[model samples]
Target: MISKTTIDQVYETARLEEVIGDFVQLKKSGSNFKGLSPFSDERTPSFMVSPVKQIWKDFSSGKGGNVVAFLMEHEHFTYPEAIRYLAKKYNIEIEETEQSDEQKEQANERESMYLVSEYARKYFSEILWESEPGKAIGLTYFKERGFTDDTIRKFGLGYGLDQWDAFTQTALDKGYQLEFLEKTGLTIVKEQTTGEPRKFDRFKGRVLFPIHSMSGRVLGFGGRILTNDKKAAKYLNSPESEIYHKSKVLYGIYFAKQAIAKEDNCYLVEGYTDVIQMYQRGVENVVASSGTALTPEQIRLINRLTKNITVLFDGDAAGLRASLRGIDLILEQGMNVKVCTFPEGEDPDSFSKNNSYEDLVLYLDENAKDFIQFKTSLLAQEAANDPIKRADTVRDIVNSISKIPDRIKKEIYIQECAKIMEISEEVLYDTLAQIDKKGFAEASKKIKQEQKAFEVVKNDQVVEKVDVQYELERKIIEMLLLYGNLKQEFEDLVLKENEEGELVLEPEKIEAKVYEKVYLDLQEDEIELTNTQFRTIYYKLIEDLNEREEFTVNTFIANLNQEMVSEVSSILMEEERYVLHDWERKEIYPKEKGQGIAQLVGETILTLRCNLIKTRIQKLQKGTEGNNGDNSEVLEEIVNYLQLNKLLNAKLNRVLS
Candidate 1:
């Protein structure tokens, strides 16, 4: 356990923007910082960081909390681990209490895998620097590639020994479990016929690159073999596992995310070496596809930072053609795509190794072509002197243009493409329309096929039957979180029976704190929230409000467990997301919720009571049919309930049934 004092100090010292900006590209938005949500695939910026409150919220994913919570959600770190990360970031010393045996035994599976992967990074790094063959082979290979000592250490480049079981034995000896070792692909385990199981190092005799998640946790490793052996593969990557999914993981992303956002662009390359080399040369906003086909997940990762992508291609025609498939995916994401080809004889790795940073950047600026131009030029060369190939290339380019979500961008590309191919504008537009029509028909068919499956899934997995009740209960919690201690004049509205018992609106204002008003109103109705968690939070807030002069959202959140924290955050942030105060800037003035806080709070409680009354009325109706005694009182009770329900509907501004 970390000391409470240490945790407090870390939280106090950690700035929300500083912590999250390390992984996300946060830009100034009025009083807060905004960026594309790291938690979801979004084109518009919705992730918000509030330095004043020391909390961040993803309007897209509806995840929000203090700085520590952000790490816990994004890095998948345990609570203590998030605190430790913050402490390390701010250079604070941490004092931890010893873990109990039961606590150690209860360590989670995902966290255990993280522990093993992190341990392996350190272990491999140690071997690369201190061991004989590692120093001579691994360290030597990195240095020979023109990587400086700082560069090697910064990226955590390491080496696996040639010995069959070097890494596996070391990890096992260190008390790391064999199950995790095998799962992480750090150890290759095979069953022997009669003896103990045989195991070996997976990356033996290879230099290593530790691929990191956005929060800098070790997810997996990429190893490059240095031998000239004809039988061996040149590079091997960690197989898919819990923490590592290569399609979603960009090499050097943890290091380059800030730069990518700052530069307003991300440079996509094919190899880890290319990213590392170029980044070291001061072009910091660079990432590699890691030789895999580029995936939309990878594109979304970059989209969180910026919408501009420049793909760097080597001069080789065959590899370049193979890589072109990825650019359409980038375009489909609505990102600006620019392609840069190095000199015919050189790749980014080789070129950056020799050229000055200034020269390399200048070359890129001068040579980079828009994807449409690059595709047209490259394909036009291939389609030379063949009418069928020319027609096919035109269709292929049109297909890519159709993939673009922005119709204006598609038309712009179409115009540029027609000029390049010497074709009329009408022909290109006709081709695009055909492709879109075909795509829509296929998509509609797929949606129809899956509509039944979609119906079974609940909204946020909460049942629809009582969703409105849940909303009202959750609204009470939101009111407490946002304005619990603030005192304001709450309008008390009533309908008067003037002589004939006809309704007349009468209004008065009563000054009270928000929580006091909510508590008293619920107390008067003798009603409680139906949901267990909401009820717990409701009582906890009431208790805290009574016990203290003021209630702070952060302090209240800190007292809850992880589950309640997420629930409470969702309620608070979802309210903020729906808030229309900021929409006025766009000429969309909306009625502010704060304008009628009293009505809002009062109506929520009234609605809950109204639901209960309706339930009771149904019971009375059923009882009247079954009762063998006088049913006058039961029918009278039902009539009175109906009248009370009418008054509640009137108070709620709903039309009476």
Candidate 2:
């Protein structure tokens, strides 16, 4: 368990915007920040961060809470993991007790795999630096690649021993479970007919590169073979475990996320070394596909940090053709892409190794071309002196162009392609229209087929009836959170006999604190919140407001359980997202909460009283109908309750039948 002092320090020191901004690109919007929803695939931003409250809310997903909540939701981290992540990011020393063997056995499967992978990373790094074979081969290979000792250690590059079962035996001897080792692909285990199972290292005789999540947790490793083995694959990755998916993981995202966001662009490469070499050369905003095909999940990872991606291609023309399909996927996500090919026979690793930082950056800037232009020029050369191939080339470029979501950008690219292909814009536009029509037809056919196969039910329109008691309870909590400690003059209603010998409410002015008024009013009527969650929060909120000289939403929420924390955040941030639109600038002024908080509080309590009286009247009416004897008494009680409900509603300016 982390010490309470350290947890509190982490919460105080970690800024919500700064922590979330490391993963999502946040742009300033008035008092808060807005960015694309990381939880959902969105073109516009619906994720909001409020620095004043030290909380964030994803309007799309309806997930809102403090900094710790955001981390847990986004990264799938447990509560302790989130705190430790924040502590590390802010450089706060975390005081934690070591877990015993019993406690370790109780950990969940995914967490166990993560622990095993992390342990493997440390063990491999030690071997690379300490063991003779590792020093002779793995360390020497990294050194020859021009990687410094700091870089090697920074990435946690390590070596897997050549002997079978060397790593497996060491891990088992240390009490690390063999089940997790097999799950994380650290040790390969095969069941045997004999009493003992056969086991060996998965990355034996290979140099290891640990892959990390966005928060720097070790997910798995990528290994490269050192010696010649024609039968074996050149490179191997950790198997598809619960924690690591190769297609979704980038090579160096954990290291490059900050630089990518800062530069507002990401450099895309094809291998782990390409990323390391470029980063080691001072070009820090670079990541790789890890020798796999580009995936939408991977593209989204980069999209969170930057919209512009500059794909660094080697001089292999055949490989370039194979990579072009991935560029269309990027365009489909509404990202800007550019292509930069190195000189003949040079890749990102070889080129960066040979050039200085300045020269490398200059070379990239000079050679980077728009994806459309690169695709057009490269294909047009192959279509030379052939009209049929030329027509196919035109359609292919248009197809790529149509994948873009923005209509204006599409039109602009069409005109640009027209000029380059020496064809009129009309021809390209015609081809694009035909392609769109075919796509729409195919989509409609699929929808029709699905509808025919399954029975489709359409829901009737629901008439939304307001929940009077629930809303009143929620409003009471909101007011207490917002203005409970403030002192104000209130119009106190006193029920007294009027000149006509009837009960009437007469207004009397009195000065009192907001919480005091609410508490006294509820006590006088003995009204309690009907909603369970609201009732729990109501008492705690009042207690905190009464005791503390100062109140902050973040601190108040910190004391509540996870469920209450989410409720408080939702109540507080309900109207905050609308601020992103700047309604005042559009000539629509909203009523300020600060101006009439006292009236709002009184009206809320009045509404609650009216609802309770109505409920009493309902119960009296039902009792009178159900009973045959002494019905007159119940009728009189119902009449009195109706009169009180009418009087309260009148004061609230509510029209009732």
Candidate 3:
């Protein structure tokens, strides 16, 4: 465990822009840096990083948080890993309080897997650099691939020994459990005829490539065989595990993310070496599909950085007819895809090796073909003088175009396709509209089917409906975070029962801090938030404010667990999202909470109380149905609740009751 002092030092030293800038190209926009969202596809810059507030928000994805929170979301890193990453980046020394045996035993499943995977990455990197067999095989293979020593180290390339149990033995000796080793697919466990099971290295004898999450934590490894044994598979990847899901990960996203964001273009390739060689040659914005058929999740990963993807293929690798079979997914994601083919008899690795960096880059720029033209040219060659095949090829091209989400892009592609295939533009548009209508109908049908599948079952007794005040509850915490320490004087609008037993609002001057008033109001009414997470935050806020003379968002967040931090961030940023749009710029006076801090806090609590009374009145009404006794008392109670609800709503300036 890292010491609290060390974590705090790292947090204070790590600038939000400086940290996020490594993975995103940020241009100064007023007081903040704006870039294309690292979490979604877009042409305009919607991702904002504010050094003043020490937070970032991706308007597209609706994810906003502080530095550590960004890392956790972006990299799928555990809390400790995120802290350590920041500590390393900012050059802060980390001090640890070592965990005991009991603490180790109590560690969660995800943390254990991360620990084992990180250990394996270090172990493999060590073997590649130090061990003789590793040098003769893994290091030699990497060098021969034209990767420099620094590049290999930067990417964390490594070697897994040929020995059957070398890694397995080292891990167990280091106090790592055999179960985790097996779960990470680092150790292959085999059952014997009699006695304990035998274990061996899964990546034994293969050169290793550690696949990283966007924030640069090792999630899994991909190993390539040095020997082309006919009976064995050429490449063996880590099997599915809790820590790594291949579909959600790109091979070199962590390395290429910033480049992709800066260049506003992503180069898609088929293998790890393709990305490595291109990156080595200065085309840093490239990632591989890792030989798996590209899943929607994979396309979406690339989609986050840029909408433009230039897929590079060696001459023979272009089974253009077959390649187009998978490209519909990219179009569906609204990516502007272009195809670039290398010289005949050459892959990206060999081509880059054979040509100078200048020539290689110039050739890619000149040869890149928009998808419509690329598909038309390739299929036209195969369709040579055959009208039927030509018609079918045009349909295929139009089909891909129809999947495009941008209407303007679709229209442009329609024009290009019509020009290339000599088909009428009207016909293409008609076909596109038909496809879109059918798609909408199918989607609607699916939603209906899903809705039908959702059924609620209850006991014979009445089901007590939970009438929640989430918005008001959220407002209460928001005010606590924003203005809890600020003092305010206001006319007390507390409703009271006079001697005649009539409810009336008695306005009187009362002065108190926001937190004090909120605490007293809730305590007086004995009201608590019904939502579990909000309730927890509410209590923590009161305790902290009570102990200190001041309240700040940073102070409030520091005490929360990761889950609670995310919850608070969501509530705080939900309003910030609107503010970020500059509604005030449009001749609109956006309601500033600071203007009516006292009123906001009181109204929030009053609204919650009013809602609770409404719920009770509803229950009483349910009770009254079939009740033959004491109708006058129930009527009076309902009227009183209604009057309270009306008074609360009036205080909020709400016109609707």
Candidate 4:
């Protein structure tokens, strides 16, 4: 267990914005920061971060919590893992007591797989640096590729020995489970005809590249065989397991995130060497697809750090054709994409090796082309001779343009296409509109099918009830947030009269405070707001009001979690969007809506408190007038009720006036 002191230090030192900004590109939105949702695909940003409140919320997914919660959700880290990660990021030392064997045995299988993968990574890296075979094979292979010692170590490159069962035997000796080894594809298990277990090393005689998840957990490995064995595959990758999914994983992203964000663009390449070579040459903002076609999931991963992607492809014709589909996928995500090809007979690895860092940077800058223009020009030359092919090429480019989610970007690309193809803009626009209509129709059909399926499992009445409650809660919360601090004067009773004739009633001055009354009334019912955003804001308001200080809207809003701030802001402003016509505007003064909202909120609070006081007064009067109880305590209670009622009435009257 980590010491509580160290956990507190980590939480205190880890700034919410700094921690989250490492994953998402956030731009200032009012007092908070807003960015595209990492959990969902959307063009407009719905993810918010509040530095002041130390929390984040994704409006799209309805997931919002403190910084620790974000890491737990996004990175799939356990509570302790999230804490330890934050500690490492903030440079805090973790003090942990050792776990007993029984406790270790109870750990989950996924965690065990993670432990085994980490152990394997360390073992391979050690072999590469410390053993003779590793030095001669793995070290030499990287050195031959022009990789420096620092680059080799930074990427955790390693070599597996040529001897079969060498890794498996060593792992078994070290108490790591053979089951995990087989499950992670590090060891191969062959079941005999007799149903016996037989184990052997999976990547024997190959150099190993450990693939890591975004949180720095090793999930799988990619191995490259050095020997010329025509029967064997040159490179073998770990199969999909419980943790690693190749389509969603981008190699070097764990290390490239900061540079990508800082530069506001990512340079995408094909292989591990490409990333290493670019990084070593001072172009640090680069990652690889790991020799796979780019996936929407992979593009979304890059989307988290930056909106701009520049794909670096080799000059080989096959390479260019193979990569164009991936560029189309990038365009489909509403991202800014540029394509750059190295000079003929070169790839990113070879080109960077042949030039200085400054020269490489300049070469990429000068050669980068926008996706539309690049695709158009590349295909136009081939289609020049045949009319059918020319029309088909135009349609192909239009299809790629149609994939864009943003209409403005599509329009801009359409105009550019017009200029490049020497065609009228009207024709292109008409074709795009038809394509968009077809796309929307197909989408609507899918939505209808989904809705029908959902309706079969849902109860309409229950949904209606929930909707009603949601609206009511939203209205009440809005009022509390907007006018909870407003104050008014009230009348309080002073002194009861002489024993002689009749009781005298004198008015004493009092201040009508809505916040105190509302807070106290809510407390009496013990009713808590069910909505997370509302509940967070409600508790915070109660805390602030209890401090007996004047409430500052800016200060209160500032202290809320980022998700709640955006939500609260949207709720407060959603209904105020319309501008009045001349006659309607004349009858309605500008400040009426503002004052009316405050008065309605204040009056509702006062009324609720007054009703409660009236009920208490009735009980007191009944106790005093009947012979059921002693009158003195009841009389004191009646006196308090009268005082409270007087205050409430005064506030209501002031508001009415």
Candidate 5:
């Protein structure tokens, strides 16, 4: 367990925007920062970070919390892991108490797998630097490839020993479970006829590359075998597990995300070394697909950082034509993509190694071509001197163009295609329209199928009515969080019998803290928050506010359980979503929170009272209907509740029918 003092230091030192900005590209919007939602595939900026409150909310996915919660959600880190990550990032030394065996065993399966993979990374890295065979084989290979010692260590490059059980035996001896080893694909287990399980290392005799999530947790490993074994594959990757998904993991994202955001463009490459070489050579915003075809999940990872991708390709690779199809996927995500190829005899790995950093940078800049220009020129050469093939080439380019989501961008590309193909804009536009029509028809079919399935489920469910009381209770909590510590003047309504013998509400002005006024009003009415979550949070919030000399939303939220934290954040951030739209600029000003804090508090209390009184009146009327006699007192009570409800509603400016 982490010490309380260390945890407090982390919370105080780590800035929410600075931590989240490493994962998502954040741009300033008013007092907060806005970025694409990392939790969902969103083109619009719905993820918000408030440096003032030290909290973030992703409106698209409805996930919001403090910095710690964001790490737990985004990186799948446990609470301790998140704390430790922050401690590392902010240079805070963690003071810890030793864990008991029971405590160690209590870790979940996913965490166990992560621990095992991380151990494997460390073990292999040690072997590379310390072991004789590792130094001779793996270290030599990397050095020969022109990687410096700092680059190798920075990426956690390692090598598994040639012996089959070297890693498996060591992990077992260290008390790590064989179950986790097998799950993480570090040790392959086989059962023998004699009932003993056979276990061996998965990446034996191979140099290892650790694949990390955006937050630098070791998700899995990609291994390349050094020996000339014709029977074995040259490269192997860790099998998918609960913690690691290859399609969603990029090779160097942990290292490249900051640079990618800073540069506003990502360099996409084909393999691990291509990324390392380019990133090592001062081109920092580079990542690789790790020899896999591009996936939407992978693209979405990059989409969080930037909207532009530049794909680097080897000149002599035979799959150049096949790779062009992947560029369309990038375009479909509404991202700008450019293609750059090295000179005839080289790939990114060899080219970066051979050339100086300045030359490599210059070469990329000079050769990079827009997808439209590159595809048209490459295909046009093949279709030259044949009108039939020429027409097919034009259609192919237009098909790629049809994938763009933006209407203006689509029109612009169409015009550009017309110029490049020496064809009329009308013809290309007609092709784009035909493609879109077919696509829309297919999409409509899928939606109808999905709707039918949804209707079946929907029919079996009960539709819940809106809970007005819950909303009122939630509003009170919001007000408490927003203005609990501020002193304000309030209009307290006193219900008294006027001279005409009718109960009437008289406004009395009073000065008090907002929380004090709210507390007094609710206490006088004997109104309790009926919702269990609100009821639990209300007393705790009130206690914290009264005892502390100051109130901070982030600190208060940090002390609550996740469910209550979510509720408080949902209440507080409900108004933040609308901040994106500047209504004042359009001559439509919305009520500011600070300007109406006192009225808002008074109105929320009034609405809750009205709702409660209305409920009481209904119960009385129901009781009168059931009973045949002695209903006069209940009738009088209902009438009194009705009068009180009317007055409360009047104060709230709500018409009662």
Candidate 6:
């Protein structure tokens, strides 16, 4: 475990906006900084970072939390991992307690796989730099491709020995598990007739490139073969596994995220070398799909960093034609996409090496075309000779345009395409309408199928029901958050013997005491919140109330898990939005409705507690009336309930008047 002192220091020293600003371009908006939503594609800024509160909210996704929560959400770091990231960023030294061997063995499988991959990366990198064969072959190959030693090391380039089972033997000798090595696809396992495991190197005689997740955890590897053997593939990637999904992983993202966010744009390329060359040429905001056809998952990963993508292609006509489909997928996610092509004889790798950084930048800036215009020009020549091809190409482009989630962007693209293709805007709109109708029909069919499955589960009564007590608990929580500090004068009940020889009520001084009343009432009833989020908030409120300090919503939110933060923020903000709006406009006077709602929420909580208390009191009465009953606990609770009833009456009197 990390020392509490170290954790406190890390949290205290780390500025939320400073940490997040490194990965997002935030413009000041009033007291807060706003940027494009990192969790989704949006032209308008909906992601907000509040420096005063030390939290961020992505209004688009309803995700709001403190600095650690942002790292967990955006970079996919676990709780401890996020803390460690903050520690590293703020230059805090972390001292953790040593774990036993059994404790290490108890770590989660995914984390273990991550550790194994990281170890392999270091081992391969060391071999590449330190070994004679690795330096001569692998390091020389990278240098021949115009890669600097810094660039090579930055990408974790490495080499595997040519001898069979060399890596497997080394890994086993180092106490690494053979099973995980095979599972990660670093070492292949063969089963003989005797059912024994035979392990061998999977990327022997190839230079290695370690693939990393956004948080810098090694997920897999890509290897390039050295020899030109007819049977051997030129490039081999780690097979799909639990930790590494090829379609979702983009090469060089771990390095390019900050640059991409800073520039507010990302350059999409085809290969590893393309990414390296572009970065070396001072275009640092570039990443590669690593030769795979782009997947929606990969696009979403980039979407987290920037809303604009510029795809770079070589001047080879066939490759350009083949890659146009990926651009359509990007547009479907409502992202801005531009296309640029290099000279006929050059790719990004060759062009960047041959030209100065300024020339490359200038060339791209001058040649880049919006997706609509680029697609139109590319398809127009083929369509000129054939009317049928022209109509089909028009439909194809319209289909791509229809995939855009934003209607305004769709219309803009439609106008651009119509003007370029010499077609009427009305015609393009009509065609897009047909495509949308077909898509809606298919989507409706899928929804119906899902609903049928959901109905089966519903019929079985598998869904958990929210009880009345839960609602009451939530209402109480809301009131405590909003009106806990609001004070009012009220009549306090005091017992006295009157002339009639009976107990009588005398008025005494009292304050509203919202937090105290709620806490004492909950304690009297022994009612526990069943909802996890409500329970978390309730306990936190109790802690604050016990200290007699006003509850700070931001402070409470900062300490919660990201998932719980979203849940709590949604509950708090959903109700407050309309209330605050009405108050601001001065359209709704604070009269009966507002006061009545507050009173009702408070009363409902008291009623629930009172009923539960009364039931327990009855049980206690029965047990005491019988034999072997200890009523001390019950007596103490009854006395507490009487005091709570007095307090509740005091609060009710102020509301009633």
Clashes of each: 0, 0, 0, 0, 0, 0
- Ranked by TM-score, the better of candidates 3 and 5 is 5
Q: Candidate 1, residues 1-657: lDDT per residue as tens digits?
A: 788889878866778788887777777766677777888877777787766555677877767887778888888888989989889889999988888999898879888989999999998999999999999999999999999999999999999998899889988999999999999889989999999999989999999999998888999999999999778789999999998999999999989988887889899998999988998999999999898999999998888778899999888887677777899898888889999998888999999999999999999899999999999899999999999999999999999898888888988999999999999999999999899999999999999999967666555685447577777888889888777887878776565777887656577789998899888878887887899999999999989988987566766777787778778767765534533236757787556547777667767777888888988899889887857999888889998888878877787778974
TM-score of 1: 0.89
Ranking by TM-score: 5, 2, 1, 3, 6, 4
Cα lDDT of all candidates, in order? 0.86, 0.90, 0.83, 0.79, 0.90, 0.79
Off by over 4 Å in 3: 15-76, 437-471, 493-507, 510-512, 520-536, 546-550, 576-590, 605-657
lDDT of 2 by residue, 549-605 (tens): 897777788878777877888888777756766788899887766788779888888
Candidate 2 lDDT (Cα, 0 to 1): 0.90
- Tens-place lDDT per residue, model 3, 420-472, is 88889998888888878888999999999998897745566586875458778
Q: Comparing candidate 4 with candidate 5, which one achieves the higher lDDT?
A: 5
Candidate 5: tens digits of C-alpha lDDT, residues 530-643:
999999888888998899988888778878877777677778777777676656678876776787788888877877777788788888788778577888888888887887
For model 4, residues 275-349, the per-residue Cα lDDT tens digits are 989999999999999999899999999998899999998988775766789988998888999999888899999
Please list all clashing residue pairs in model 2, or write none if there are none: none
Taking all chains together, each candidate's TM-score versus the true structure is 0.89, 0.97, 0.83, 0.78, 0.97, 0.80
Give residue 592's lDDT in candidate 1 (0 to 100): 52
Model 6 residue 8 distance off true place after TM-score fit, in angstroms: 1.9
Residue pairs with backbone atoms closer than 3 Å in model 1 (clashes): none
Query: Lowest-lDDT window of 10 residues in candidate 4?
Result: 574-583
TM-score of 5: 0.97
On lDDT, the candidate that comes out on top is 2
> What does candidate 6's lDDT look like per residue over 1-657, in tens digits?
677677777777888888887666777665667776777766566677767657677777888777888887877666777889899978899989877789677767676677778888888888889999999999999999999988988888899888898888988898888878888898999888897778789888899989887767799999999988889889999999889999989998888989998888999999988999889889999999999999988997787677899999987887677788899899877789999988787899999988999999999899999988888889988788688999998998998898888989888889999888889999999999899999999999999999878535445566587676667777777666655655644443456777987555576755666666667557765777777778888888767656756556665665666787766555554432333234647676444323754355456665675546555667766766756656788678776665555555554453322
Model 1 regions lying over 4 Å from their true place = 24-69, 445-468, 490-510, 577-587, 606-611, 632-657
Q: Give per-residue lDDT, candidate 6, residue 117.
A: 89
Q: Model 1, clash count?
A: 0
Least well predicted 10-residue stretch by lDDT in candidate 1: 572-581
| Residue ranges of candidate 2 with Cα displaced over 4 Å | 97-105, 450-464, 581-586
